[model samples]
Target: MRVVMFGYQTWGHRTLQALLDSEHDVVLVVTHPRSEHAYEKIWSDSVADLATEHGIPVLIRNRPDDDELLQHLKDADPDIIVANNWRTWIPPHIFNLPRHGTLNIHDSLLPKYAGFSPLIWALINNEPEVGVTAHLMDDELDAGDIVLQQAIPVSPTDTATDLFHRTVDLITPVTTGALALIAAGHTQFTRQDRTQATFFHKRSAEDIRINWDWPAHDLERLIRAQSHPYPAAYTFHKGNRLEILAATVSQNRYGGTPGRIFYRENDGIVIVTGHDARTGNNHGLALTRVRTHTGQELPATEYFTTMGGYLTRRP
Candidate 1:
């Protein structure tokens, strides 16, 4: 099938690579405009570069509502459109251009995490399983009919980056299979249950802030969810922001104040969380890896050496 691809970020890059490896002919590629000034540029390959290498046209538009985009779609005349992690909402006119219509590959199981940062949100919420869904695109965001889906296990130690990689690996095969089935008219899509749909907002800096009042297990999940590629969970310490990269639920059951930096331990610095006020569980989470403001990530042990004198329990 003649396919037009739309995507950005690492997940998008993976989808583009998978399509290139498959039998489908990608007619055009659309991606967000590259930002040179962002502190951490997430997009790895220039979709334009991949398109040019394959002799496919490329469109770089920040917003899908632009009139030029509509004209570009009209010119390419694709048989099918595949969108992966596309940041912008595709206008209805463009979605209806292709004969087979547009398909979206979202990183989460739809009718659940339907909006931005599904993987991150799932981890933050302590979901044991995360999956990907390839669905027919509609005017609403991720509110479309499902064609294919595959679930992946989320380990207690899995970070957002880890979950993302696992999800991409699982989805590649599902996506390829779904596309072939759709092109061959062997598949029937089903509309999603709108009542079960839930949307999540983009993760902001504030979202990454560590709230010690939360349960130790919940705090641990939050730490793992935001670890590595997604900005680590952070908290203010000694008037400086500290990003916590790795943590473990402590076996100790001392009923200490939440956010209290306890004495340094063998593995790293131990921190206490609020006694689950509801359940009365006293065990708290511990930080194993961390970074001080404007500093590179360091083992919690190494970081505590220089700053340990200033560390005090959070009030």
Candidate 2:
């Protein structure tokens, strides 16, 4: 089948690579233009690079509403259009261009983490299982008919980066399998249950700040969710920002104050919880790895010593 592929970021990159490896013919690839601003430095290779390497025509557009994009879509005349992590909401006309209709590969199971940063939100919210779904693209974001879905286990130690890689691995196989089924006309698509749907917003820097007052389990989830690749959950230590990369729930129940650095152990730093004795659980959180304001990543032991044990708070 002739295909028009739309994607961005690493997820998009993986999808494009899969299509190249598959039996289907990718006629054109569409990707967002590279952004080189102070806040957008995380941007990586353009999907066009892969398409160009494969000798396929490539189109770069910031938004799907562009008139040029509409013209390009008409010119491509693809049999199927597959969108993977395409940031923009595609216009209806583009979705209606192909005969088989456009298929979208969403990171989370449909009707769940629909909007953006699904993987991050899943870990932050302590979801036990994460999955990918291939669905028919609709006007509503990720509110489409499901073509295929597969689940992946999320370990207690898994970070957003870890889940991201796992999800990608899960998605590639399911996506390729779905495409092959579609090409063979052997699959039936089911509409999503709108009542079961939930969407998450794009995670911002403000969301990365660690809230010490939250329950130890919740804080632990957040720490793992944002660890490495994604920014680590941060807290203020002696007016300096400390990024907590890894942490474990402390088995000990000694607690006077939340966010209080009780003591430093060889394994990590044990901090007390600030919950009221009558109502809140007095569990401590152990800090394993942390990043200092100097942009240095160090173990909690090294960090506490380097700061001259300044994290202690007045009782």
Candidate 3:
């Protein structure tokens, strides 16, 4: 069966590679255009380069609803459209263009994390398991009928970067299996339950700001959730912004004012999360790795030489 692919970023690129390696005919690829800012993440190894290398037709457009793009989608005449990490809203007219309808790949189980950064949100919330779902695309956001779902257990040591690689790896096999089912005419759809659904907003600068007032475990989770490739969770110290790359719960427990350095080790510092509003207990996050404002990565002991002042939300 012919497939019109829509995707962007490493997630999409990996998915495209899987489709190319499979038996399906990929007719065209629709992806986002290049970015002006070099730091912008949306401009990763997009479908354009991969499509060019593979000799597949490519269209670069942010919005897929334009008249010309719609005509191109119509002309491609794809039996099905496979969308992964596609950034923009795809109108129903375009998704309905294919013969077998559109299949979308989401990073988490549907009816739970239905918006951006689902895997990160799941880990930050300390979900025991994360998952991948392949489903039929509809007019709404990620609220599609699931065709295939598989869960991966979340380990305490797993960082967002770790889960990201593991999660992207799931796409190749999940896509291959879903496309096989579609090709064999054995497609089965499970309608999503609306009551259990959660729609998270796009992660912003505020989300990355660490509140030491939060439980130590929660703060630790937040730091790991945004670690590396995404953006490190951070806080303000002595009128300077510092990025906390990683942290863990203190093994030797002691308590003080939240965000105040309570104990300093050769490798790290234990900062108190005095009492959580929800949990009603004292906890302290042991900062093991940090990055200074000068962009120098250092151990917490080196970074906190003068630490009477508390870490704050803003500098």
Q: How accurate locally, in lDDT, is each candidate?
A: 0.79, 0.79, 0.84
* Local error of candidate 3 at residue 282 (angstroms): 1.0
Clashing pairs in 3: none
Q: Taking the tens digit of each residue's C-alpha lDDT, what string does model 3 give over 1-315?
A: 899999987888988999999999899999887654322373277778999999999998887878998888889899999999887799898888888899999999888998888888999999998888999999888888888888889999898888888888899889998888888897567999989999987787888998887888888889988877777898988889999987888776665677787677546788878454233356578898899899999989887876666888888
By lDDT rank, best first, the candidates go 3, 2, 1
TM-score of each: 0.89, 0.90, 0.93
- Candidate 1 residue spans exceeding 4 A from truth: 36-40, 263-266, 275-280, 294-297, 301-315
Q: How far is candidate 1 from the true structure (C-alpha RMSD, Å)?
A: 3.0
- Rank by TM-score, descending? 3, 2, 1
Q: Model 2 residue 195 lDDT?
A: 93
Give the Å error, residue 119, model 1: 1.1
Name the candidate that leads on TM-score.
Answer: 3
Clash number by candidate, in order: 0, 3, 0
Residue 129 CA displacement from its true place in model 3, Å: 1.4
- Report the C-alpha lDDT of model 1 over 1-315, residue by residue, as the tens digit: 888999886667778888999999888899887765231264355666777788877888888887877888888888889988787788888887899898899999888999888888898788889999999898889998898989988887888888877887865787787898798985478889999999998777778788788777888888888766566778877788888888888776545466666656558676767645334367767678888889788888877654223333241
